[model samples]
Target chain A: MRNRQKTEKDTPLGAEAAQRRHRAVLVILAAALILCLLLSFTLGRYPVPLRELLGILAAKLGLPVEPFWTRQMELAVWNIRLPRVLLSVLVGASLAAAGAGFQGVFQNPMASPDVLGASAGAGFGAALALLLDLSNSLVTLLAFGMSLLTVALVFLIGRYVKGDRLVGLVLSGIIIGSLCQSATSFIKLVADPTNKLPQITYWLMGSLSGASWRDVRLAVLPMLLGLALLLLSRWQINVLTMGDDEARSLGVNAPRVRARIILCSTLLTASAVSVSGMIGWVGLVIPHMMRRIAGSDYRYLMGASVLGGGIFLLAVDNLSRTVSESGIPIGILTAFIGAPFFIWLITGRVDHYDG
Target chain B: MTVEVEHLAFAYDEKPVLTDVSFTAREGQFLSILGPNGAGKSTLFRCILGLQTKYTGSVRIGGTDTKTLSPREMAGLVAYIPQSSRPTFNYSVFDIVLMGASRKLSPFRAPSREDNERCRWALEKVGISHLAQRCFHRLSGGEQQLVMIARALMQDAPVLMMDEPTANLDYGNQLLVMRQAKALTKEGYTVIQTTHAPEQSYLFSDRILALSGGRIIQDGPPAEVLTGETVETLYGISVRVVSLENDKMRVCMPINII
Candidate 1:
């Protein structure tokens, strides 16, 4: 008889290999994140060596102090670079988590939080705030609110179309994004070109320039809430990647899960946008890097994306400061680095999208 | 556990797909839904699985109304393998099968050792344990189908609903999948499968439900329901149904038609 053998006691290596790879990737990402944070703290116009940076941080924490404490170095490291680095890490983690969640929910690697008009909506809200000269807190609130509202609008429109949710959602996002961009331009056109317009344009280009302890405090609630929600929803995201029908069969209330993920992702995107303006590429590239490194399991993928994104943006922000006499927009630097890397990744792994 | 569907009515927009369809599958019975294309068999499966909420019907599992159960609870009772689904990403065969246990595991929890064992067991049951490490999309169509069935088995649900499980397989693989599905029924799974092959329904199914234009036109043992007249009426083609020694029937198209 042919080996119609149905039973085999042999355990497969796929699961083991996947777990090992995931663990290794997590370790690497954690190490990279720590290294980037340290580098960001150390390297600047006036480069503080690693030892001095550590010494200053330890001294600030009331640890036994190292003898070298210059006021200029103290001011540069603590007052200038620290807040920017912290903000970059927070914003990057937020965008990356949002990207991972969006990709999982939509079952499309191409889907990002910004694809649903969240970023543009936030930009428009920020632009309007600039034109009206709203308070900082109010501007942040308006940006966050409008961002979520835009996603909700896209979701509603997608449902109304009664087709593939990913396609519908993306199409509606494009329409809404254009509308938001036009509104932003109109606001820019109407504002004082010398003052408000330049400020709005610079903000829209995205930076860690104005990042402060206050902005960080304002960002904490939404960022933490969004991350917690994404982490909690990660496993459901596994079933969700199977597409709507299969996910439903696996006992996931598909619409409810999709809505929750979208809400969390939008909140993450909006909060990051509100804090750092419209930094791009971290949301788009970080998740793909995570997926390539850590398999498709969202539990590990989301974690890696969070940490990896944090490190990536922090490094980019550091380069933004050090590369030029006049600091460059962090978003522009991210695009310049991210776009070529993405093209190379895609070209090498064209079969990644086959299934 | 038995599954009962009554007065099922479903529509996409204004056009109806299933209307007043009623059927029942006793515990551990292999029920094959045979129909022509667009005959609403898939719609029926979806309704029973609670995937088609727009349908007006009562679907009961183990005598409990499906509406009373949460999605996870429903999934624990019934597992579904779609006709053909494309994963958007490259997931391992084991990972795909482990998804079947999602209902039993918490959102934050990793698949437990028990879940992993079940996944391995399911893969073995489908005779694809060796393929567990392979990327799902990298597998042949037949292998992918088996992996999906393994996933459904990992659900460990009492009722298994498979839509065209053998549709894309070659002749040998077709028989192989059907044999495995039939074995599932003997293991106490109430299997409901939709297929184009009357031969498969004849050889493996305990009972056959023949659908036509959104209604059950014939329902009985395979030998009784898979008649030449019913086949002709449903498919607009001629077929031959012959009884064998074990009270099993063989269905085949006439030679001239081929």
Candidate 2:
């Protein structure tokens, strides 16, 4: 009687303790993300001091007043830094969410968005658009369309072979990626070497140089929609990771659920790739880092990955712009930072990696 | 609630596995299916679970045709534990059990307080509440089997099905699992288990079903089904069934070269 009452009293307290721990982690991550975003906005060639940059941002957002105002500062803050930071956050969030979903669906931690050739297909489409001197918006649309087509082709090839779906999907991705890379090379070969070649080469290396308000608007909505869908379907994703037979026993329509997840992940990856060209490391590394932090529950795992990925990329983008006299490509900077972190994670004493 | 099957026929890529097979399981009863390696027990289970669409059969759960219910609806009525279960990821014991509550959860809704309470209850029911935080893959074979059973209990269904529930268990764990199955029956839940061990059926099951060549050879009480001739016919080996002092039975296979 008394014992039972005591036990019941302890239950909610324990649960509340767990919830508080989770909230503490979230708050820490939120602070880090804001700090990185602010630093990214301030650290550029025409460096605005942090206090003045905040005043400029507050004024631009229709806040109370401005501390100091100048046309050059306005251009630096609004036209340049703000767009780049916003694009980095959006791309980082999308790629991390996509990677998390892919890893869940494939039941393999090593799986990423690029495993299905979506990035390669998008890269090829963007290169071709560049060779033909197409509009930037038109190139983004073409890249998205080609990515969808490539994913569909992979799915169809998997079905046609009547093989294990994961194996078929991976093999098709490898084949399609090779073909797309060769086609991209062909486009580079035929373009005017003096002009289009360098542009194509830099785009392949990836950049936030052309970040604009239009690009931000183009990416945020779809990426948000995809992330929301993934979050909603996290429980189903949890069951699917247990394998097909167990998933079926748990009342999931395994094939349909997997298809919906693949669609969501590919859509997110395609949007991010289209906007940023091809930022490689965020998709592959962020989810791994989040898994190590939050454990393997997709509910918390997905959220942590989004916050962590956004902050990571913002910091890398800041370094890309400020590290040298001539700005570095965002992709190169990301790899330089991300590769060591990935190696450390892999070589660490984490037992989950055995899977 | 009772499950009824009639005139069940199934084939895989034109190779027939089950032909005109039928059985009925009543509420609060323990039924064991015994068969050789290729006797189509798993295929029949799949058909009843509605996982096999290419079967010609009528399976009814609680007087409703199984074909009419969606997978989620069926899962709300019947819970299945496979013969050998492995976790692909390093999920904790509590996390694995909580997934069984998914059928009752909406896509956007998180697992509620009641859900977590039920998960803890199920883990305690299997005598592994202490292992709730441990990684599932770190457990031994028998412990893993119990955790899987705990996961099935989290479904809160009226019927439970298991394939070879005690296959890899040691002597004590095998008896422990059989006792759990018996306890489930007493709690007003129907249980259907497939096993190769006839002695376990005699010790715990209320009814026994023997299959050969994808067909039912015998279905009756344990005493009537565990005869030497029936065991010989099903397994293609001579066996002896002897009663022990404590209302338990023992099955021994005779030495034969052929």
Candidate 3:
């Protein structure tokens, strides 16, 4: 409210300053993400020295490099560490971008990628695949397919319901999500007690531990496609947040644009979950943080969120590995960071952002 | 441009909300829609804006029926300003105004330099260029309403349709918004607005449209249609239409006011 009345510097210079701040934050976030990716390469259990990590990266860029570490170290950096780091980046960027888009279109700050039941549906898919003893690739494919299908169902139902489009989409998502969750639980109930149940439970908790070059390759295209579509619609997403009637009056085909956004976000989220398991908090928390930093314009919010989310997950994944001998799951660590921040967010600042 | 409505009617769930509604306004004219709740003023606005397609009637703008025109084409002809309220996001006032030019913007591009200048021009027209940096949701109700008017102006359309332009405003702000709307008419734009206050209609409008029971009961100049009997019948309250000596100014004062 204090910022509301102080149009004192309402000059063009002040507006320019605000634009400068947004650009600055975006630049800083992008730089910080690159730094974190390099830093994550050096922080694991058998830590590769920073010099060795740099030399390996420099070698990859086609520059000649004298080896600072042995063949095993090179293998660790290129084979094991790099793929997992890249996976974290893809999953993190995809979720945050989708989450920010979802929040905008739904006009709800609390909205996340799971608002349309993609996560629960994908979780059920993965659990069913595991219970049936399917191959890893088959499990991922099923999960991705199911997530898209779930959202499609919710979207179709929301379309038929005659009410506020945002509310109907969200309501149908919740209902379908609960149903999928129950189906997943039923699979748990009937699974073999020892090997299969633990795998399902651990998978549901989320990790990048099993990440490989294959997963990274498979996830990158869909994530990038979804991200690109979202970035293109950032300006339209701004109009969407104003509500449907206003959007139409401005000559936007509100339903078409809203569906496009929902579709892109769903595909992005489903691809991420198929590779990384049901990672929470990255989607919900990172968008909130980006909005607070850059305000709610989707133009800056989308790019800032991608970088911010990637940096956050890479850092969290590092902490997950270094904090314990066996390494905690990435999902648990995200909660450790996200829950307290959300409490801080909601205690005083929720209502104003709604306005 | 000319706006012509013929035999416009609408219903919801077998209940008629507007029937046989018709009106026409041309360049440099100001029209006010006066009615109580459920009188279908908003529905009529929606039909004209091409938002409500299920209705049966022709809303012709410049000899082209709205039903025949695309939504984009309709936007080029009429700009709509909804009743002002706090928005969900804290978009800068400039960006909010820029959105009004979406009809001219491509889906994959930012606002062009000319669009930005137009937005600034609109801000100046409403005398709020100083608050262009402020969050739209943070402004006062009157300021928000003015920004909405500026947004409508930025659309650069020939006709402006506003829903309750002075709603939820104090007296001074009401006059401020009403005066700006009136000024738009002198610039050769057709301005149509709805208001519950008959006095505001009498004060700001060159013509009045009085609606009751889902129909236009009276439509004419303010001096003819906004009489004490029509005002009383529309709002279900008896009021005296008092005229002042200065330029024949009128005020609708309730008879019960001692």
Note the Cα lDDT for every prediction shown.
0.85, 0.83, 0.87
**What is the CAPRI rating of model 1's predicted complex?**
medium
Q: What TM-score would chain A of each candidate receive against the reference chain A?
A: 0.91, 0.91, 0.95
What are the per-residue Cα lDDT tens digits for candidate 1 across A124-148? 9999998899987888888888888
TM-score of each: 0.94, 0.94, 0.96
lDDT of 2 by residue, A1-355 (tens): 3454345334644333444555576678889999888777657788777887888878878999845767788888888778888999888888888999999988888888898888999989899899989999988888888888888888888776665778878888889888998999999999999999998888888788789988998888888999899989877888989888788777887898899999999999999989888888888899898877766778677888888889888878787778776778888888888899899998996644222
Model 3: clashing residue pairs? A355-B88
Weakest lDDT window of 10 consecutive positions for candidate 3 chain A: A346-355
Which is the leading candidate under lDDT?
3
Task: For candidate 3, state the interface root-mean-square deviation in angstroms to 1 decimal.
Answer: 3.1
Residue A235 CA displacement from its true place in model 3, Å: 0.5
| Stronger candidate by TM-score (2 vs 3) | 3
Question: In terms of TM-score, which candidate is stronger, 1 or 3?
Answer: 3
DockQ of each: 0.54, 0.47, 0.53
RMSD of 1: 3.4
RMSD in order of candidates: 3.4, 3.6, 2.1
Clashing pairs in 1: none
